[model samples]
Target chain A: MALTRRDILVGGVGLAGLTVSGCAGSPTTGGRPIPVQGATAPPGSPNLLVIFSDDHRADHLGITGEVPFLQTPALDTLASEGVRFDRAYVTTALCSPSRATLLTGQYASRHGVQNNLSAWTPGTPSFFDSLAAAGYRCAYIGKWHMPGDLPDLPGVERFVTFTIEEGQGVYRDCPLIVDGVQTPRPGTYVSTDLTDYALQWLEETDDGRPFCLVVAHKAVHHEFEPPDDLLGTYDDVAIDLPDEAFTYQTLLDRNVWEGTAGRLQTSYRRYCETLLGMDREIGRLLDAIEPVADNTVVVYTSDNGYSWGEHVLTGKRWAYDDNIKVPFIVRWPDGVTAPGTVSDAPVLNADIAPTLLDIAGVPIPAAMQGRSIAPLLRGEAIEWRDEVFYEYFADFPYQVPPSQAVRTDQWLYVEYDRGLAPELYDTVADPQQQVNLADDPAYAATRQELSQRLADLRREFT
Target chain B: MSAAAQSGAGAMPGEAARSGPVGSSSGRAWRIAAPAVISVVTFLAIDLLLAALVGRPWGPAYPLSMDALVLLRMGPVFFSGLIVWPVMRARGATRAQAVVGILATPLAFAIVSGWRAAAFFPPLEAAYYSTNPMVVGAIGSQVSSAGVGALVYALWRARRHRSGRPVSSGATPLPISTGWSWGPIVAIIAGTALTVFAVIWDGGQHLFYPWVLLYGSLFG
Candidate 1:
């Protein structure tokens, strides 16, 4: 009873069939695969490549000052090549909600995905849908953390995603659902595998139609699992930790506790290590699109910001800058007039959907609550928001109580829905959110105005 | 085996003669432990369902670490005994009664959770659960657990009967009259209303007057 080559081939096909069946109804898989048009860009249209990362802090990059010795060459290169947004913030500093905002160009309230335990309304118009309708090939690769268990996405020509245990996919030997088939044991390093898949997609896709590929990375998220090559990257590096003002112990004592207190060095080191892998993946992504670089709009950002002992907070869902602000760099070769420029315009996750639509030459839907920043990207003069509003809903895991805030250039006014007292800060003077001026008589007028403004914005948005 | 054999005539020499349908001591323990195990499994399923329906920001990889989810889920399990024990202690306690008793706890918790969510976290209900993920998840999880609990009981019963042990006599299935009681129907309606409000109705003006024009007024 010796097994022949024919038997082995049949067994292999059977295994493949089982794998495909497992991922038959996965949310990340798009429509039928389109043949590769060509290596070059589609005529008169630029391809869109958005490299999204999870739990990435704005200041953790080499250019940003969180870690001095850390080097994120790919991200730094992206920043150098395009416009970096200094004031980018997520409307709701959580993952699914923020990602929904990014996709729908709507606030958490409008999109109805206020928390991770929320689902985006199926019929809600997304930029990708509009792009696909306009004959652009849409492909979403990597982490697809939306609700409905990552069901078939609309307007996507190709969808590949992580199918590991839950939330963010596993870091090593990640389960990848490619073209609605769960590729078993798709070996090591999620970011690298994602990049390779993205590259393969770009190589295989029909280049006749312009494409939009969302290359998301599940790095720097909790557990901070890094590949073997990057495991000891920053382990030996001496890093300057945050001072007493931002100790988890201080937060615990103050009764505003969130985050790990003593694991600053270990956490930061692992974070940097994981981040380096993502950076290399970005480099690889960039390399993949090199042939069509001139005709591609490459954007890089995170779903939500992370906190490395900032305000004693370990993770996001806080109104503080560390938890809400994310690194945003867009390299649109044809659209951006001045390269390596920085825009201080207060942009948000919601702005992304509209912005993508604008780039793809699709009409911004009326359902979108965010204003397109295409003008800002092209270095044009346009009226922009002076203040950004942030909100959080209380759930079980991240016990940072539900709070709302309105942050201006100079002031930040926080209103807690439950637990703790309200906080008002002159961000210019107290950038660390250390001082509370809510009860201070001198700032009563400012607080009153900001509160009124916050209410107004909430009413307008919600 | 005949009734005599089932009553322990078939027992080995020094072994205690089997009397009732409950087979071994372990089998009896299983009968007692089945409800507790079902309760935990059902609640875990509920939590997993909620996470999946909503989207797990923390993801499923680390279910136990999600402090909020754990607390939310544990609340029902901790208080489940208040209902389960009472039902189990009722007159004519049987396998069906125990199954129903085990499931009643989650149902009560779901209603309480719905009401509390509507009252306190109105904004959350209005935003995230507008499409009713919570309601569907809660019910789906509750029913799933109930099925699992019944299965466990059924399996244990089958094993006891298969072992030729005489089952404890006089224990009857839930009466038809009791099964069709009005309490469950009313509870279902009330729970559905509360869940709907918590998941859909806004606590603002929408709470008072929910009707809104979808395509503008008829007068244009």
Candidate 2:
């Protein structure tokens, strides 16, 4: 195909237009991407404020119309200012694996640390360390579930840690020890105590320095006990049962921990009550950062998703949608595209690190398995990954065999070693994942393709 | 057959008697054989297996004979598979329930067993009873074994009543309540009691019958 005179003339004009615009005002990318509607902090510098929650779900929010009794005005404010990732997800569903992947920009298998049994050791080159080295002051508050042995970190000025309930620590009314002294309950609650400490840190911290503050909360983990103040708030409001809540239809063949509807409903109600408390606490933390809102980037996310009895399974060990997907929101008023636009780009916990590095103008390590979310931030056409891999190794009580999965937006392929079989679900059609299509004749092609991809992923990561 | 001939409890008359002189009961002696010896041996083997496989996992603190789950494990198989719905008539349990029961019971048993395995076997309702996986087997493994032994005694009673033609008519068989059972119960009690002394003497529960009781059920 030969270039005509008209085609050459048109190309010349377009190229000439870009050249002229580069010299004027703030030179933004011309034809490569749609100009982001929100403010872009000139070049690469922005305050990072990551507000992470545990076991919180996107659909559980009051704005989502599912959990109306809940109050999350701060998270709501962040979403109002920036894009709420309507379908963001954690690579793995368990706690440590999820956080490890987020920090290292790699899946749990590559990192070789799966559940709460193994701690995420320092010297592992977390993005936090990279940000600190790049001259950003960092502070991590709230539950450091990874490992409590905080090694000397250069840039992190504040660190708070607590083990979850049942891990040799009491959760609700128990006194929390900070720096080796058992701090008496300021009042009659543990959740408020932690929040007060975090809020105090925010107010007392030295200012004028670019900072990255991560506030991780343990509101909704287990034995769902809220502070006395928030205890009866959602009691009057009838808790909306998660769609798969009370599945009394026991498969007559498969044997498991036998539980009754009274157990499931009672637990689900308590789970929501705990979430409601966390939602209120989030509002408190947001009010803490309201003064520096312009320069700050607030991201609200959870470690992993939890299940409410879908497919007769009651917990978070499996790689089903209910357990793997979590809420991810990025609200940097100065950065991020589409003041309120949502994208279907698949994001991993690993990408959280590089995305921060990209926002902070820190170079992403070549060894990192995650690609930065920066391109998506600029509204550029990013060749984002099509599928994400996930896995979990055994932890004491959850001593199930290791499992691996490949999840596309539409399809999820998994293998449960217990059944010694592979399962495939087209989440597009069956979000409930009632039917397993791995053995279906029609899905042989799709399964084969996904299987190959899963194999390739394991090999590359291994 | 007359009551005397049918009993099979006596010997035949002396050689001086005519060919068919014994009061006729007919040739009905072939209908029976004593199942007592086999029953007790089977009983011992099952208990040993239960103790070895299920009992040891709970730990060495428990002696083999006192595991309550041994009863639970056998009761369901007995009531459902035999008595209530005889194996021939009753619906058996599914494979999954069996696996869960088999797998978890051993853990539960071992835990219960170990709490005092070194101290010897305690009754199911002892101080540690509430802490262990309670037998809820109403009458669990040990009692089930006792029941088997009692059935044997009943058979021995019926077997001894013969009176004619080498099988007697005068001797009366014993009642089920008359069997030599307290000995076995006391033997188990003694074994458990001795286990405490043994552990204290040797400083370990793993010393006694490591091969026969503990290792056999776990591996074999």
Global CA lDDT computed for model 1: 0.64
Give the CAPRI class of candidate 1: incorrect
Question: Per-chain TM-score of chain B, candidate 2?
Answer: 0.22
The worst-scoring run of ten residues by lDDT in candidate 2 chain A lies at: A249-258
lDDT of 1 by residue, B1-220 (tens): 5434544553321112223354677765555455556666667676665444322233443323433444556545434543343223222246555555555554544454444344334544433222233333344344334333333333443455567653332232322222223333344455445434533332211221112121012111
Model 1 regions more than 4 Å off: A1-42, A245-262, B1-220
Highest TM-score: give the candidate number: 1
What's the lDDT for candidate 2?
A: 0.53
Stretch of 10 with least lDDT, candidate 1 chain A: A247-256
DockQ in order? 0.02, 0.02
Candidate 2, residue A274: the lDDT equals 75
